[model samples]
Target: MLGLFIAQVLNGLLDGTYYLLIALGLSLIFSLGGIINLAHGAFFAIGAYLALLITPYVGYFGALVAVPLIVAGLGMVTERTLFTRFYRIDPLYSLLLTFGIAMVIEQGLRWVFGASPQSYNIPDILRGQVFLGDFIYSRYRIFLIAVAAVAVAGLWLLLNRTSFGRIVRAGVQSPEIVGALGISLRPYLSIVAGIGIGLAGLAGVLLSPIYTIHPAMGAEIITLAFVVVVIGGLGSFWGVIIAAVLVGLTKGVLVAIGLSSWSTAAIFLLMFVVLLLRPRGLLGERILRFE
Candidate 1:
């Protein structure tokens, strides 16, 4: 039982890593850009598909490098043509617009790729297991955990150490004050949207070897991602990290207890309980949005 619990904890923590990536990006968009982007899942799905499509031609590493750039470009275009229009409108308007975009991307993928679950072969380099005392662990899974850790740490440095990150952090607090200093927000807004959606795309690409890729894959994860984002609070990246691990732990423990069906319900319950008690989330500031 102890071994099983330890294994479940490992699984849960790794699962939380990807959830962290998705929620981190979502929090940035919500807090700074003020876009409740339902289309985030689409970008994630696209990243996966693009990786699959490119793998045959470019190999896995190439796909990882190339697909994110392509996804970032797509995100930038999305911001310019669609998200920009909703900037001055009510926040709900942007959410609805992104939701429409999500639906359209889903259908488009279905039309182009069909509704099949596409498989990705794991590279031979990461396919084995490491035996530790009485337990064995998959190398690929450990690699994923390490990668997720590096991703989060890198993003933290990006947002907290660099000038670009500093501006973004300040903008999250209040864009108005930043804009008053003569920095035109239009370009920065596009960059931020690109990064948010790009991170989703990156998440998708990394998930290619871990899960079957399909049109409905994004739909499956988005709800969970939203729960983590809300649980972690809207504006705080650290909150996203904590919330993601919590959700992952909940699902893992519930599955171990033989109630696999309750995974989604578990998240809903956790979010509800957290909100009921904390109201502003673990680290989320109360009423960050002035409107």
Candidate 2:
């Protein structure tokens, strides 16, 4: 029983990786561009479908590399064509636009792939279990955790240690000042959108083996991703990380305690309590545009 409990806790912590991937992108796009991208999940779904298509020829490893780039390119295009118009305006407009975008992508996927759920087998190389003492875990999940960690760490370094990141951070706080300095944020916006949407794509690819691949999969996961972002505080990078862990921990504990049915509800309860205590989120910063 004790080993089971420990295994569940570890599993829960690793599960946070998925939320971290999706929420980071969601937070980044909203923080910099002020666009609440409802279609973000659609990109995730697209990634999974793309993987299904490309993996046959290029193999899983190849699809893993190519899918995110493809989705990111699509994201850049969407930002240039659609998202650019809605910046600096009422967020409602962008929200509605993204919602429409989401619907269109979902339907387009349905039209192309049909409404059926698809399956992608785990690559044979990663198909196995890792036993640590009495606790056993999926090898693929361990790999997933490692990939997520690297992605998150790399993103942190990019945002904190690079010139591009500095400009983005500044723009998020004061677009007017960034513009005053003659720094055109247009290219940055497109790139950020790509990076953000691309993260979602990567998540899609990683999870495709384990998750049920269907048109509604993106829609199903987006809400939980939003919860992570909200709990972590909008625009707070570290906050999102912590919140994902907490959310996963909460669910894991519930399951471990034989109250699995309440796991989902407990996550909401955790969010409600956090909001009651800190309205701006765990680490949300004061952005002039949001203020």
Candidate 3:
């Protein structure tokens, strides 16, 4: 039972890491772009599909490094051509546009790759398991934890320790002020979109090995990602992290207790509770919009 408990906790922590990656990007995009990108999941699907196509040529590590850039470039293009138009309009327009984009991407991928799910094998190096006393865990999972931790730390540094990051955060708070200060926030907005989409791509790459790659995969996880965002608050960075961990751990514990069926529902329930108690989210700041 102790071993089982330990294993569940480990699994929960890893699941939280996945949520963190997805939610972080969602938070960044919504906070900075002021648009709820319903197509964010499409970027995720693109990353996994791109990995499947390129991994054979460049290897897993190469695909990991390359796919995010490719996706980011695509994100920048989409932002400039399509998303930028709706920023000044009602956010509803952008939301609808993104929803359409998501549908298009999903259908396009399905047409190209067919409806069957694809699988990728973990690299030989990351295979096998490690023992911690009597508990054993997959090395790949440990690598996931490491990768997620590093990504989070790097993001924190970028946001808190760097000038560019400061500008982006400031832009999030006041775009007009940023522009008035002789800084063109337009470029930063594009970069923020690219970075946000790139993070989603990264999540897809990491998840490809564990989950089956399918067009619908992104749709499946995207709602949960939104739940994480709402629980964490719309624009709160640390809030997403905390909510993700809490949801992940709670789901893991529920599954361990033989209530696997209720894991997702448990997440929704938690979100509802958070909403009732703290409507602004755990770490969310003042209401940004007049909804």
What local distance difference test score does each model get?
0.85, 0.94, 0.89
Model 3 scores worst on lDDT over the 10 consecutive residues at 282-291
Distance from true location, Cα of 187 in model 3, Å: 0.5
On the 0 to 100 scale, the lDDT of residue 155 in model 3 is 85
Candidate 1 at residue 211, lDDT?
A: 85
In the range 12-85, model 2's lDDT, one tens digit per residue, is: 88778888999999999999999999999999999999999999999999999999999999999999999999
Q: Which one wins on TM-score? A: 2
- Residue pairs with colliding backbones in model 3 are none
Candidate that scores best on lDDT = 2
| Tens digits of lDDT, candidate 3, 1-115 | 9788988897787688886887888888888878898899899999999999999999999998999899999999998999889888888899899999999999999999999
Give the per-residue lDDT of model 1 (tens digit) for 1-291.
888888887677667887777787788777777888899988999999999999999998788778878898899999999988887789989988988999999999999999888889778898999988656788987876777787789888988899988888788777788899987778878888888888888888888898889997888889889989988888887899999999888888888878999987988999999999987788886545643
**TM-scores for the candidates:** 0.95, 0.99, 0.96
Worst 10 residues of 2 by lDDT: 282-291
Q: Which wins on TM-score, candidate 1 or candidate 2?
A: 2
In candidate 2 the C-alpha lDDT for residue 133 amounts to 93
Q: Is candidate 2 or candidate 3 better by lDDT?
A: 2
Task: Name the lDDT of candidate 1.
Answer: 0.85
